[model samples]
Target: MDRTLTDIPTAPTDRVYIVIPLFNDWEALSLLLEKMTKTVAPALRKRFHFLIVDDCSVTNYASLPTDTGYSLSIMRLWRNVGHQKAIALGLSYLADQPETHTTIVMDSDGEDQPEDIARLLEASAQKPGQIIFAHRTKRRESRLFRTFYLIYKSVFKLLTGKAITFGNFSVIPPNLLRKLAHVSDIWNNYPGGVIRSRLPYQSVPAERGARLAGTSKMNFVSLILHGLSAISVLMEATAVRILLFCVITAAVSTVVITVVILLRVTDQLIISQGAIYIVFSLFIVILQAFLISLLLVFIVLTYRTQSHFIPAKQYGDFVEQIEKVY
Candidate 1:
């Protein structure tokens, strides 16, 4: 697939849609709507539409204010399919619409600045086929959270060999959006699919802000689950890394063994220390080699069996049903 962003007409049209995934932050949602109405470019304001995909929040937002002077629509999911899935559903909905040439996905909590939308639009206009990712330059989060995020980024890069620090805040052109809509293994990869798609894309630095309303829905458990799911997406690469480590260990063990035999022959071996160290090191090398080989075999089997794969159609159907009723 050709993943390249091409510059297109910048004339404002009724083709851009801003989609926000919400799960009960009515106050912040309201604020976000208000900010967007005031912040969007005048030429594009009349043509742009706002889509709020409700992820089964306990509170009913059907009666909330909708008079934002722009085309506004709310799509309530039948159940909570999580944030990522909800975003996918919103994009899918827009993808089905003929006039949607570009779609922007953002969080409803106002953490993602509304003013940045213009920058995204400009970037998209410069490179029509690219997805403009809003990467946070400075975070207002706690130190511990920042540390964890750094670690996650490091591991993600090591495994996937791609540097992606941003999350869901991005503007995807219609064609790329359609491609993502058909990605069957999206749930397994989260944002990995975006990078792996290798479509023309660019990243713009933005500052992170505190939540504009209710408490964050993400907890420790949810974060850990998300991390593990991301890791699973890059399992094949990780498996290769494990194999490499095992090979290195084996090579080191061989060299150590040769050195030990030489020392013994030359009467240069420290009898007690040399014997114990060599034996322990060799045992660890053998054990790690076995474990790594087993892990590689398991990953291959899982990939072949499609054990953890979730088809995109199934995900789409599930979300469609959720959008049908309470």
Candidate 2:
């Protein structure tokens, strides 16, 4: 399905701190917050606060609303980090806040659906101390996109030994913040990190909502990068898996070459010139596969030794400015 975030009807919660990242989508953000006002319970109107991470958008920030009951804060980054990194920074910013509160990570462009927040809140109430995610039961993307998405998911599971069932639309309980904020993998992909961490998590089914105000900047290339980013979070495991596959390929090829030579020598079969060439060519494949496996092993070992940037500690370095707009 083709979606232009022009206008759409699309959530509830405690003093939930809603964290959203934006890039030239001020109008959609404004409309999303407006809908959020009507979604939460009446008694919890002021309880919902918002933290918007501006990814150095060239668009003016003054296009946002000024008067709202919700407490809104904008954290502007020095450079354009993607939404995944922006979310990691936002979580790090709130790492030391009240432990009784919960943080909601969602999209501002309306595909996440504000109305479904109520369902998430209710689920969170029932399962305290666990992360809750909005699982898409139905998607509205084009058929081609869905096909690629399915392939991505399959590859992710095969490489990482874990299934990715959710995205950034998640409710993270504050009790886990101090620890999770420091997790390095979230800088690449939030949901992937959560899965990799082996944290307690649950999902509430939601249908994908239409975009709110403008066309999405997401294209095929960006989508592919998104998949790669998610997979990258488990680089060590992926490397190991690939290494094993390469080893298996080389072993099988060696066995085939041995059998083909033995059959010809024993006069059990007459090998054609093309067949002989093909059998001998396995040596090149075997050598290449062995070299690739060795490289992967070196990568996995090196990755284990290198120090990485931790979000909770380094996020402040990327923050340029922060303002409370409402």
Candidate 3:
């Protein structure tokens, strides 16, 4: 996953737009945009468009120095809805545009690496229809950050029964873009939603790069919420698993209660004093577990019945304005 930058690959003749979600990271974005302008060949750069999703940043978009050589645009949201939603809205916006053939989603911070994008593009070419994911083989983060990230991945797999190793960085084909626009879960978690979408996708091993500018905005609390959001998209599966656990706990408690009862009736010493407490505890456990299982069943049913927002349908509501810079 430790990658050495090679000569920039020739971009496809077809038009491609790169979508990056920005939240007060204009400095990094400005540098990245400029670097991309110089790194990519002129003809190739012409075919590429930069779509910046300003997630209601406090800084004025106009203040950020623009590189006019590359085609760039900014989509400002009505409110800050976090990075995942910003990416979702951006993808939704592009799905409607006529010129959108391939959409690449990446973070404005250099952690996603502008150079790796060419690798993503190359992977997309090998398999024309399949979505290409920039899978992380190694991370350039602190030990604590990496540890927490690994734990998050494990918990995600345990709850959702799917292993997600990728993030926002990926290549979306024209046909798949349409399908993804309708998937509501993408609004919460991009990679998780894509996994649930059941679309064919392939992952190309890529190394994580250092941030280009300021410190990361993702704190511990934010990381927890982000992880929960990903898990939330797979709520149905999680609910079922919880229900199953409850059922198993109830069953075990029931057996224990029956054993305690038999012991109380047959053995005088067993029921003398503490036997009542044991029986009562087992019964309480069974009742609580059973009730929880029942509640989860109802919750899952309600969730299924609810009408969730379809990105294709509701994306426009969040968009404040779209400005084409160059």
Candidate 4:
């Protein structure tokens, strides 16, 4: 059904904003807005406002229809600040608004269900200080994409010791939103920061929907980079494992070499053959180098606090301007 902003209900004090971070998916965004306005619960209809952050879209926003009656507002960032950063900007904007008490962030492609908004709101109301994330029970993506996502989720859990099976589709309470606003590293790590925060959060299972229109903006390279960025949060954990591996390998090599030498000297047999000695020497040298490198990494990490090592400020600014029109 087509909608003009007038179709949406409004109240002076009841304020809830839905933030859709748009990149190049203008067509998909249009359909998403239509569905949201027409299908969302009436109780949620009155206070609902829609904020579209055009992440430096190459297309002109003026060309897009804005007849939807909901308090529609568009913030064209100076440039494309990427998906996560764009969402961060939207959250910041809502948090600053006196009327906005709850904010929902979702993708513009319509992969997240609009009907789930009510469920998230109910969950948020029950847990006032929590963030309600939409957890997908079954993903209607390609086999390759699903496989990669599953592997990535497993690896992330193993490294970070945190479970994150969801993405940006979430309803954040005002209190939690305030806390997130104060977080300097939110854009850089995106969902990682939310998971690491260990804040009170709940998840509602939502059925995934097909894209409303247009191709997805996320390419293979972008997905890989995002995955790496998320895993970077567990660098400390990976470094410790590397250090332990290096030390154990070095110690085993040393013990083997010493035993070989002692057997050659005390026994009638020449246990330390030339080939054996050369192989052992090379192994020890390589292991020692690995150990030294890990030691250096440990020293650097020790001197730098978790926040400093990640360099949240620089990362945040980089995210802030990713789509800024040049």
Write down the TM-score of every candidate.
Answer: 0.85, 0.92, 0.90, 0.79
Task: Give the local distance difference test score of model 1.
Answer: 0.71
The models' CA-based lDDT, in order, is 0.71, 0.81, 0.83, 0.70
lDDT tens digits, residue span 1-326, model 4: 11123333454555777888888787887787678668776566766677787788888543443444346766667777788777777776555544447888899899987888888888888887889899989888888888888888887777666777888899888677766765555666667767656677778898889999878766667777777777665556555655666677777776776666666677744544774765578676767767676685876567455454232223233222222111
Q: In model 4, which regions exceed 4 Å deviation? A: 1-10, 61-69, 248-326
lDDT by residue (tens digit), candidate 3, 26-116: 8888877777766666666677777899999998644554552346778888899989999998898888764447889999987887778
TM-score-wise, the better of 2 and 3 is 2
Candidate 1 lDDT tens digits, 135-184: 89988777877788788788777776767678778898877877776654
Q: What digit string (tens of lDDT, one per residue) describes model 2 on residues 92-170?
A: 8888443336888999898898888778888988997899999888887889988888888898999989888788998
What residue pairs are clashing in model 2? 1-141, 1-142, 5-213, 5-214, 11-114, 11-115, 12-118, 15-47
- Determine which window of 10 residues in candidate 1 has minimal summed lDDT: 1-10
Off-target runs (Cα >4 Å) in candidate 3 are: 1-13, 38-43, 61-69, 268-272
Worst 10 residues of 4 by lDDT: 317-326
